[model samples]
Target chain A: MVALRRAAGEVGRSVAVHTRARPAQPQLHPNPWDTYHHTVIEPRRRLGLDAVRRGMERGEIRDDLDVELVGDLFTGPLLIRTVIRPGATLEPGLAERIVDTVLEGLRPRT
Target chain B: MVALRRAAGEVGRSVAVHTRARPAQPQLHPNPWDTYHHTVIEPRRRLGLDAVRRGMERGEIRDDLDVELVGDLFTGPLLIRTVIRPGATLEPGLAERIVDTVLEGLRPRT
Candidate 1:
């Protein structure tokens, strides 16, 4: 859970910084959304997925989990709160709460 | 799980249909993203959120869960798989898998 929180927090903070910096730059592309997806979104997603997979390999996560789907499960909320949802700010314990839910979901059932 | 799957499937299908029909119409505004978010995304999110809350009230979900955050958990994947992920197609059992993870997380732990 700590790793999950740290990884998510790092990505979220960087995205916030990037968006705040965007206004200073002139519109460089007719399709900025596509560029944003390829450059910003995709790499971050890959990094998060890698983190999750590493957890699984370390016997921390379930081996039966679908990597892509589970990757979305973690990445989706971070993206939504940080970008899609309006007026969303980095509240205290935000990453911790997300990681808690995920850990509870992904923890091996006894 | 069935309710979750049905709700997600309906929303995913409608979004797919709407996007397919978009290209034929001339671009009406410079910022269609905002319009799309308001018209399509927000209401769908509310509906999904309502379902989770209802589940909690009925003792199907954990009473202590955060409603808005849980709503994001349910709505996030549907949007990601259906809209954000490029070349993503609606796969069989996708909604079931997503709901299974959520239910496992949200179910009152013994």
Candidate 2:
């Protein structure tokens, strides 16, 4: 989980740089989407899904939860800060906070 | 809550259209950021924050949670499907699913 949080934070920071560096005319760029998908989204999604799967196996997460959607829950807000919401600060510990909050929610109700 | 769901869905659909219609040369367009901020981000953030505040008042959501971050969790995934992830379907009930999942995670653990 610590590694996952670190990877997520690193990805968020890199994405911040990537978004800023995007050419104003994306069509002139050599398939930015492909680069973004392969480099950012795919790896991050896989890592998050794996983490969630392991959590389920350990009985930390709800068995019935859709893992893909759970991945989105983890990825979305970070992406919003780094990609969509311009000028929003990608504060430190954000990744950890998000993970903790979602995990708290996902813990099976006693 | 129903109204919030409906509004979120509508906003998601409208954002789909808005993104698709954006001029490739955004610099040539008239202050696209301003338009996007005013039309989409600000209003949606306000609505989500208001709903979360009401939930807190009702003892539904964790009062300690940052309402803005909670709003980001709801908005980010929808934006991911509609705006960030090209070729991803903004399927019906996506808004409801996101809302429900986040709310489930958010419900005051008692």
Candidate 3:
């Protein structure tokens, strides 16, 4: 989880740089969707899905939950912060807050 | 909250329809980012920001959290499911799960 959040922070920083670099005509650059999928989502999907599968194997994550969905949940907020709410500062606690919310949802329910 | 979730479901359905109709070529259609902002984000932003303000005034939501940030949190997953993970079914429990997760995060922790 720590590593996953660190990756998320890195993704956020990369996106921030990309966004800042193109304030005038965002569309003139390569499609952000393509850039995001190639640069961020694919790699994170591998790492996050692997992590979730390991967690489930160790009885930390619920086995029934969709690993892909869990990956999306964990990364979605960071995506939103960078893409959806571009101007917002990447707060120090934002990654922890997002990771906790997702982990809480993914944890095996008692 | 019920109304907001209902609105989200509607947005999901609309996006699904849009996606299903455009299986041949997505970029040929209007920029989904524009469509999303105009058709979905703008209205939802208005309604959601209003709700968050009321929630904050009523002392249900913490004042410290950014209202726009909260709106993004509540809606980001749906956006992801529809736009980011377009093929995934809108699972019946998806909305509740997302809302519950956001509410848990927004709830004042002791």
**How many clashes in each structure?**
0, 0, 0
lDDT of 3 by residue, A1-110 (tens): 46655664555444444533433432344486567656655665676667667766766556666676665566566665554444557777776666665554321223
lDDT of 2 by residue, B21-105 (tens): 6556655565986786688667756766786677667666677788778777777777666555666777778778877777677
> CA shift at A60, candidate 3, in angstroms?
6.1
Model 2, position A92, has a per-residue lDDT of 72
- Indicate the TM-score of model 1: 0.73
Ordered from best to worst lDDT, the candidate numbers read: 2, 1, 3
RMSD of 1: 5.1
Native interface contact recovery, all models = 0.27, 0.37, 0.15
Candidate 3 is graded, for docking, as incorrect
How would you encode candidate 2's per-residue C-alpha lDDT over A3-88 as one tens digit per residue?
A: 65565556545554565565566555658767766876677567667867776676666667777777677777777676556678
Candidate 1 residue lDDT tens string, A1-110:
46756886666455544543332222334277567767876787778788777777766667677788777776566556544554676577776676678667532344
Candidate 2 RMSD computed on C-alpha atoms after optimal superposition onto the true structure:
3.8
Backbone clashes in model 3, listed as residue pairs: none
For model 3 chain A, the run of ten residues with the poorest summed lDDT? A101-110
Clashing residue pairs in candidate 2 (N, C-alpha, C atoms within 3 angstroms): none
RMSD of each: 5.1, 3.8, 6.8
- Models ranked on DockQ: 2, 1, 3
